[model samples]
Target: FDVTFVNKDNLPEYVWANSWGVSTRLMGALIMSHSDDNGLVLPPHLAPIQVVIVPIYKNAEQLKQISSHIEPILLQLKEMGISVKYDDADNRRPGFKFADYELKGVPVRLVVGARDIEKGTVEIMRRDTLEKSEAPLEGIAGHVKALLEEIQTHIYRKALAHRQEMTRTVDTYDEFKKEIEKGGFILAHWDGTTETELKIKEDTKATLRCIPLDGDTTPGVCMVTGRPSKQRVIFARNY
Candidate 1:
């Protein structure tokens, strides 16, 4: 959609303009590409704050000491070029901040408290696995950096695994209907005609997503027209 000023001649219409962009559809595709039950989880490498550090304290002195102890770790992370955030919100409790960051998809969370400082350890939480482990605070920069990389790979694999599970290959039109109803990428032979493509779309509400560059080329009859074909194209219902 576009907004434009239409020009007019002295006594008649002179020019008309039209514009179009499909970026919102791209955003919708990204949102659906990674479907997880835990909610929205962005790729770790793409997130601004890969690690969020939340300080826990009761009194002013504890807060001061915790701040001092965390300074070196934060500086070390910065030097290593890791994106990190120290959430020191005065009003909200630690639990609230934890949920907020997870919803925002922070890959790792570091919880530091008076006990952690005394014990010389910090609680490290991974967003992908939602697992927490206590690790030594000394030289924590390396641990945090490695954890970020692991989470990055983990979420990506999770998305790939989901896509693999949802993908289906069908040999006949009947089989295509059964599989496509499950809602995912369907690989099937096409007679390669625009008419059959539109007919199947009108019948099943599934459209040709793409003729995958790496699609299977084994010989088979088209699912709709039963004509000889070389490769299986991908069909699916997409927004």
Candidate 2:
């Protein structure tokens, strides 16, 4: 139920509220917002395993050496509170490991080949854009922390942009009915009456998702009833 305050005596008559937090919708939202044909494109902060390191070498001796070289690097990452995995399973090739982690949505991947160990570097790959770059292991702790933050911001911006693009601004009821069919957020003026809100939903199955915190404030008339409205509210056919 939408209630303004914890106690009935503490709220203004017009204020509205609801229980807002994580729910079953979170999984659906994440999948719809970010996942692609390649697989899930998880944001770094939410990934259970943020970094996966795959070791590549031509021989058992080099594999042993690479392991020794990367042990310190893994420890450094762990000390920085970065979740890391050294994928040392011998049954799978490095290429297979890469594809596996990419499918599993590890936000960051490091390929530590024999050459990289000799050169004191690692090949880092970002899952979001599938971009790879070589980075020296020196001061890797700080560099990785920054990269994770960048990935987080990048994904968030991309999702917000998608939402904005999906939204429609309508000034007429006919346009509302037609736009609602496409199924995204709708920005429209309403008559500030629950009767008009319910009627719109009955006719088009669209509901007022919210009067956006930063919604349009220009004086206008409701799209349905033409009654004077002070601002535009967000309407949507949400799941």
Candidate 3:
């Protein structure tokens, strides 16, 4: 799977890489990072349905009329490069559909009912913030596009902040152990020996995740085995 696309002469001396396939364990990380008591808050880029359009009506004739009116709007949104879904399932009620879409992490939901049709507007609900607003039927495509971009950027910033807050730097074994118990990445010095690495794993259950592409070259002593060290390595109990 590691196909080299570059010329042999242009390759670097050490091309370090690791491939870890996604498994059910990734779901655990997702839930830990994004879920709350109410439900999961999905990143906008990962949501299957960017916007769910649910037309509410009492009778079949009313449902048909509402659907016909919303068809062109849906098509216009699609043409503008927005992912949209129409939920017209008869089995579930509107409340049930709302709950289901929220669980699946749809970024936005638009409810277009008989009343909304008369008012020339739609009820919009944001999954991440749970904020509801009324939007005019005409400019929904552009508004939704902007809202989705904002949600995507917000999720990335939140996740990056969590990663930064979890990272810890320790110069002593006692501090390393204490921080590792709190469950986060630990940056520490190592002697660059497989034997010491194995011993650390045997004792703390933490392994070197990466040596980092760019690190300080200042010489130091290893924290574990008291051997001469060159650079620090990031260690963690990985997912």
Worst 10 residues of 3 by lDDT: 12-21
List clashing residue pairs in candidate 3: none
Compare candidates 1 and 3 on TM-score and give the better one.
Answer: 1
Off by over 4 Å in 3: 1-40, 214-219
Each model's TM-score, in the order given?
0.86, 0.84, 0.81
lDDT of 1: 0.85
Ranking by lDDT: 2, 1, 3
Worst 10 residues of 1 by lDDT: 12-21
lDDT by residue (1-239, candidate 3, tens digit) is: 45444557886454445555355667667767775565878776776678899989899998999999889988988897778999998899999999988888888899999999899899999887789999998888888889999888877788889888988888888788888888989989999999989988888899998888786567787888778889888999965
Descending-TM-score candidate ranking: 1, 2, 3
Output the number of the TM-score-best candidate: 1
TM-score of 3: 0.81
Spell out the clash pairs found in candidate 1: none
